[model samples]
Target: MDKLTVPTMAELAAKGESPEILFWVGCAGSFDERAQKITRDICKILQHVGIKFAVLGTEESCTGDPAKRAGNEFLFQMQAMSNIQVLDGYNIKKIVTGCPHCFNTLRNEYPGLGGNYEVIHHSQLIQQLIDESKLKAEGGESFKGKKITFHDPCYLGRANNVYEAPRKALEILDADLVEMKRCKSNGLCCGAGGAQMFKEPEKGKKDINIERIDEALALNPNIVASSCPFCMTMLSDGVKNYNKEQEVKVLDIAEITARANGL
Candidate 1:
């Protein structure tokens, strides 16, 4: 693989260059070790398809999804305002986020606070790329006969109604795409929403992620695909709890697409 060239928005600004879109590397995508790989694959896809994109780098702050979800509206607004100021300074008009949490807040909540931009989730962006014929998935590793099931993140599905784009991205692989009994608008959360990931379950009969994984495992999928970083972590942990880590793999949509496209 060739070395990846990821430019920071600051670098682009210094050169009087503007990117087609800003890649918002959320908290997980930046700090989480596992999620960093997903971030890189997302970048590789953008680079492979010649999409001029740049990360905010040090200028970027937390989208405050967790803070907002945790009921700290004041902190959330403060973070949002700071981020908005930086984004406005750079004149960013379009943004794509690897995490659904960031995607939701940036697209929906920010507008009320004076930060407006055309925000798209990575899965949506991938579907767009496929539709444009820029990503053929022809020269990459074959998922031709594999069974893959996608776990919808709460923020991406029910909260925002972005259901089809991700499914469409996976459909191109000619793989067996199975749906859980509760999916789409009826999709179950991976137990990580509403800042739940930061706390332990409050004496629940069963863990939500475990139940979700049970639904996916029932399909006997070879791989469990997820679009959100929180879902990835929760689903992965659930898989481990079942001792099925070797039998089933958990991967992000961007990672799957990157591997399938050999990017």
Candidate 2:
């Protein structure tokens, strides 16, 4: 793995420098082992493209998405307000995040609490980079002609109308892009949204993640691409449940992008 350097907003501020954008490392991206790879890859992309970016580091907090989703409004507000205060103190005007939960909460829910910033998902940022020619998709990459199915994150897709960004990012790879029966506006959840991820499922007909993975498996995809860390966990668990981990790999969009770019 290549070493990565992520500047903290505090460090940049002390130097009388302001980053063009703030990289919000959501809870998963910061602490989840699997998600950490995606975090590093996004950092690699931003650094490679010469984007002046900084992270809040210890000043960052959970976006209160899970608390809000789990029906804890008071806790959610408290968390949101604390984060908003720190962001406002730093005068953060733009933010890019790897998790849709953070993106949705910051982009939509934060303005009400006085945290107004331009928020973008990593996928959208990658798409913009590609469009700007800061990133290029060259031939002969590892995924060329391999089948891949995209699992849309709820916050990124229907909740925010971001169906095109991840798809556009995936297009940079040399792969066969396939869609499950339920995708885009009609995509299925991986049984991890709305705080379901923290609690065991109630007795149900089937695990949502398994049911959704079944749809992906039905297409015989070589890779299951996801943009959210939560979705990645659930979908990867679904693949393991079916004992198909060897045949199929669950990957985040950032991981795929970094690999394609040889980062």
Among the numbered candidates, top lDDT falls to: 1
| Whole-model lDDT values for every prediction | 0.94, 0.92
Candidate 2 steric clashes:
1
RMSD of each: 0.8, 1.4
Point out the worst 10-residue segment of candidate 1 by lDDT.
132-141
Off by over 4 Å in 2: none
For 87-183, candidate 1 gives per-residue lDDT tens digits of 9999999999999999999999999999999999999999999999988787789999899998888899998999998998899999999888889
Model 2, TM vs. native: 0.97
Clashing pairs in 2: 144-174
